[model samples]
Target: MAATEGPTVAQSSPSSTPLPPGMVLGPDGKPCRTCTDWKSWSKLAKTKKAQTQQGGSGSESAGASSSSSAGSAAAAAVVTAGAGTDDTAVNATAPDDCPPDREVLGRATWTFLHTMAAYYPEKPNEREQTMMKSLLSSFSQFYPCGHCAEHLRDEMKKEPPKVASRMELAWWMCGMHNKVNTMLGKDEFDCNKLDERWRDGPSDGRCD
Candidate 1:
């Protein structure tokens, strides 16, 4: 059977507050809280003020005591959510080492998907091709960003995955990514450089 499970769609909370400009919408046309930047999700300022205790001269990051008793708990949360948000006002600004937010999460996910496509078998067998297609479909259903999943699912329906060869799938995935980047008002990557970006690195041997 095909992957049919998807996020439980719901309406966005109807409050006096309006969604921020870059807000993401779910399949049911609701504001997707998990798919939006943390900053947009709340109106409260997230930057933390430096503590001014007497004789305390170190910044938050430089402080050796930064790892409080909550370190393990925070790490576990990050492991499960793929990113951690400091809910406390005192720690609102994400630490330099903290987990990724929505934007960071999307970038990392795209990198993994593109790289995997680049390395797909040159001539996939029947089982491999079917599995690759299924993987894409299932990923669209369960992707963390609801709007992104909807967009990907719609795109997949319009143009099914091309798994005839590694190069074909790689190029197709690149084009789809560029579509997303464009919609997000970001620069579109050059499809011709897929191998260089994901597989071989640059020709300058910088990665070597």
Candidate 2:
């Protein structure tokens, strides 16, 4: 009789089975010699989980800080808006060691003067130059209103009803002065004629 063929090796199935400790099956279902040790695999998993938890905690902390910052900013704005306009009240609410009111007014006056100087057209005529100089000098002197009421009244009397309001006139003059100063500082042409046009009108004390 012919020799019987030995039993052939059975083909493994595609589905994987768990092997013993420190062993794993490859994609082909054969034992994987390169499988990581169980201890190392467990340590890696723990490290990954810990990192995820830390990341989540950090994100939460950042969100809380952002919310806190936004709340603080809003509260500050509200506080500022609630403060009244009275100079004394304003000063009291301001930070300690704030600049004196006179100093601030003086600075503002100079700023206005400088602005006017720049905006006034530089006509070669001496009258225009003199008028521009006088306007700047007047603004510099009359600002801070401590003792310049008489001079201010006189000027107001000279202006027309349409331009007489002290506050309105002051604002316009200061604005013009600021613009002139800015232009001059930037090396632009200085035109001193703008003040002359305004000065020609009858002085009315109410600008509003």
Candidate 3:
């Protein structure tokens, strides 16, 4: 089978040579493509021959140039794949591409959840509270990304959802998101800006 790559992997750091050797695998012992970013998965499939050719070249400048060119070409290929109707590859999309990957999907999901949380009533009646709790519980159970869902489930066990008020829920969700961000080695977002970032625009009217 001809291998196609993901968008993120098309242009990777030098430390990620050849293939992504550090990808986390599932209990099935295969790469969890849904949980793993497209870039890492794409790296794993790069041809050994091309890697050898780059390594064998003597000139550092030439190798660097070649690598950059290759990365651009890979990015283009990813863009093309994303636009096309090909179902083989996953998570290789340009800005205008189709079939969003894990990263894009995650961003979209978080946006929706945060917005929903922000709009939640400050004092929800019992029925509203129960429904909101059920929705979150269902999300943890049925999130498309299995490993992600599992992590959420485990986190929920230790720290249950705080649905007392909109502000409380938003803060609680922000904290939960930060935990995941920390796990992924991403910088923690300031919970103080949850309203500015998610609900209200920044004070400067920049968002307007």
Give the alpha carbon lDDT tens digit for every residue of 144-199 in model 1.
77656777898899999999999999999988888777776778899999999999
Q: What is the lDDT of residue 7 in candidate 3?
A: 22
Worst 10 residues of 2 by lDDT: 1-10
Q: How accurate is candidate 3 locally (lDDT)?
A: 0.65
Write down the TM-score for model 1: 0.64
Model 1: CA > 4 A from native: 1-33, 42-93, 96-99
Instruction: Locate the minimum summed-lDDT window of 10 residues in model 1.
Output: 46-55
RMSD of 1: 12.2
Candidate 2 on 1-208: residue-level lDDT in tens? 0010111112222332112232233335443222322232233233334444444554657667665545544443333333322223233222334332322443455545434443445342566545544654565344433223233444445542122233333354544434434533534223343343344322464432
lDDT of 3 by residue, 1-208 (tens): 0011222222333343333433445445455565555554554544333444545553457647777657645654454344233425433543445344467678888888889999999899889889988999999888766667877777889999989899989998998888878766789899999999988899999989
Which pairs in model 3 have colliding backbones?
9-39
TM-score of each model, paired residue for residue: 0.64, 0.21, 0.64
Off by over 4 Å in 3: 1-19, 22-30, 44-98
* Per-model CA lDDT versus the true structure: 0.62, 0.37, 0.65
